[model samples]
Target: MQTLRSRQASIAPLGIVLATGALLTGCGLAEDIADSLDTSNSKLHHVDTGAEGKESGLLADWVPDDAEDVHVLQRTTGSERLLTFEYSGGMPSECLEIDTVGSPTQEELAAAYETDARTRDFEVTQWSTEPTMQAEWWSAGHESRTTHLCGRWWVSETEGVFHAFAAELNG
Candidate 1:
């Protein structure tokens, strides 16, 4: 009787330990799945406006020298990146001077600008509703760097607001 009771005691504790381990593992797996499904949780966003915005590396190579009241928003998820900006004091005609591929189609614009969920919330959406013109461009950075750029602009006599998007083409 004593031998049987001792064996039973050992088996009960072993069962408990196994059950606890299984529960912990199940919880961990559930958490991982939730993280994978919620991409916004993993995204990184950066906002810069005015002179500081122009100085940022994100905007420095992109924004025109004549731009003013600049507002820039950048979002990144892993290797993917999206950029949008608004500025005054630049000419719509300047699109020709930039390294653009000429006017963008409605489908191309949607793919570049509307694909990201986070970008939908940006203030630039308000300005994009009625753009005077739109352009698309590509920047093949030095060596192994390549990026796709697209943008739209609403122009007036005193202000020219531009909303642009950029993403890594190879990444």
Candidate 2:
């Protein structure tokens, strides 16, 4: 057998400690915060945009129905999490992760939302439990189109943005 040329790259005890500490240093009950970031360098915004919100004209074959107080707006041009919130029963009751476009980082999409003044302090994360596949642009000379669920929530000194967004999406 050949001699080992390099050391294994396993997480060291000290490295683990630092990682854990960094992960734990956030707002809320210290849950899985990664689920809220659309990307590492982006955040979510929550405000009353009168527009339909998230242009969803690219979906191939999809039919979404309105949930409790929120209406699903799948942005075919990008991810599906970009939907409309029609709160008839006051604030929503759960968070949601909609599908969007395949390419580009979620952080890019999140940066688009930073323009909103209603959403000043917070971040966005994408979460999904369903199985997904990598897809690509057929005519554009790509391989596959990856389908994933995403969410956007604003974090702040006070729990206002994410809480309401979760409520809307769940319903």
Question: What's the TM-score of each model vs. the native?
Answer: 0.30, 0.19
Model 2, position 69, has a per-residue lDDT of 26
Q: lDDT tens string, model 2, 1-171?
A: 443443323446668777778767854534555445434322233334323222333211111222122233322223323223333332233322224423325564355334333222434333221112222211221111322212233111112111111101111
For residues 1-171, could you state the per-residue lDDT of candidate 1 as single tens digits? Answer: 569889998899999888778668785755667667875512333455544555655453335555554433333332233334455645333332222233334454444445344333444323233222222321222111212323332112212445443432232
Model 1 residue pairs with clashes: none
Best by TM-score: 1
> Local distance difference test, per candidate?
0.41, 0.29
Decoy 1 TM-score against native: 0.30
Q: What is the C-alpha RMSD of each candidate to the true structure, in Å?
A: 14.3, 18.2
* Error in Å for residue 90 of model 1: 2.1
Q: Which parts of model 2 have CA positions greater than 4 angstroms off?
A: 1-11, 27-84, 87-171
**Ten contiguous residues minimizing lDDT sum, candidate 1:** 137-146
